[model samples]
Target: MLKWLRRSEPKEVPAATLGPLQIVKPWARSSASEPDVGGGYMTVVNDGESDRLVSASCSAAGSVEIHAIRVKGPALEMRKQDAGLVIPPANQQILKPRGYHLLMRDLASPLLAGSKVPVTLVFEKAGSVTVDFAVEEPGAVGHVTLRSS
Candidate 1:
């Protein structure tokens, strides 16, 4: 006598529906013994076929502003970017310290190391993506540790 065995088809896992919005290398300033000025950094990649990234906001600090750090006459100056940052198609923009970054002012609480900071990023085209920034030691070298959702 012979027996027959049957196999079932494998189910497919759906892809992420949040199209084209990619976040990379996101990091927040390390916790300081005293509450001082700090900022956040990240890179936004827009892989979509069109332009995106109209604005960005966060609740981690009293107010989040998009600013640019420029070297003006041997002095570093941060200026508000009123027009907002833009992430063009297939391009990327960086938000790093002493440069284009998220100005986190009036920190509500101390960002302890080995902890996480909740940050919600809002985009005009891609909607919103929330991420937790890992806290590290102050004065640590910049590294790529965060990614987009």
Candidate 2:
């Protein structure tokens, strides 16, 4: 019967867009030895109206936390990100050393320089995005080796 056939047919759904956040020049840095921890840096350009980086996760590390650094007297201090990393309208959020960065804690294995790592960032508006980060030498010039291709 036509009615039975129609009922059994699948319905078509519209495809969804990826998101508005664009990750640029992602990179990672780790210690010389079997590093159990490391730092992640990148620039998040928000094409959407606005969004917030709620959290991040790294497959290579047991825990990944969003962090920021503050200039404390003659020294700089690093700590967890309060609230969240906010992405303003058509603005960019930067993550770099001595600034806003990701702390990879309790890594399962060592992450040597020149290695690539996968990280997922969860946003309030645009949703989640997984990107690759190219590792660089510890004293590399401004993490210039980072590339997002």
Candidate 3:
């Protein structure tokens, strides 16, 4: 294949770290039928102190919110985390599917596979960090691991 024709690997963006907090393995699900909605996932590791994930934002969407899925009955419900997600000290907070994830609504455009979305996560103590979330297959169960060079 021609070098120019081959798709270039996305550059690795440094994790947002402040004090003891580090955001890692950020990724998102590709938008399918519902072009206006999508999900973002990541792991927030706190090695030193506890922190709070206050909010999030994405330029591709009108709003980005921290959310959790709950079993209300036979059906599942998604509830927004108004108070934000807490990152325990010496532990990690995982934002994944069917659990804690970022809910993106009013998307400017559908998120296609192989594309990327930039999300700004605001923390109470660690401040904020913008992560480039790789968009994976629409029905992807987990994040796509980027191979190290």
Residue range 51-124, candidate 3, lDDT tens digits? 89999999999999888876544555677888999999999899987688998989888788899899998999
Model 3 TM-score (2 dp)? 0.80
Better of 2 and 3 by TM-score: 3
Candidate 2's residue-wise lDDT over 40-144, tens digit each?
Answer: 888887667888888999989998888877765656566687577898878788898878888788888767677889988788888887878888875422221
Alpha-carbon TM-score of each model against the true structure: 0.71, 0.75, 0.80
User: Which candidate leads in TM-score?
Assistant: 3
Each prediction's RMSD over C-alphas, in Å, is 10.1, 13.1, 11.3
Alpha carbon lDDT at 29, candidate 1: 77
* Candidate 2 backbone collisions, by pair: none
Clashing pairs in 3: none
Model 2 residue runs over 4 Å out of place are: 1-18, 32-34, 139-149
By TM-score, the candidates rank as 3, 2, 1
Q: Which stretches of candidate 3 lie over 4 Å from their true place?
A: 1-14, 72-74, 140-149
lDDT agreement with native, every candidate: 0.64, 0.74, 0.81
Evaluate residue 41 in candidate 2 and report its C-alpha lDDT on the 0 to 100 scale. Answer: 89
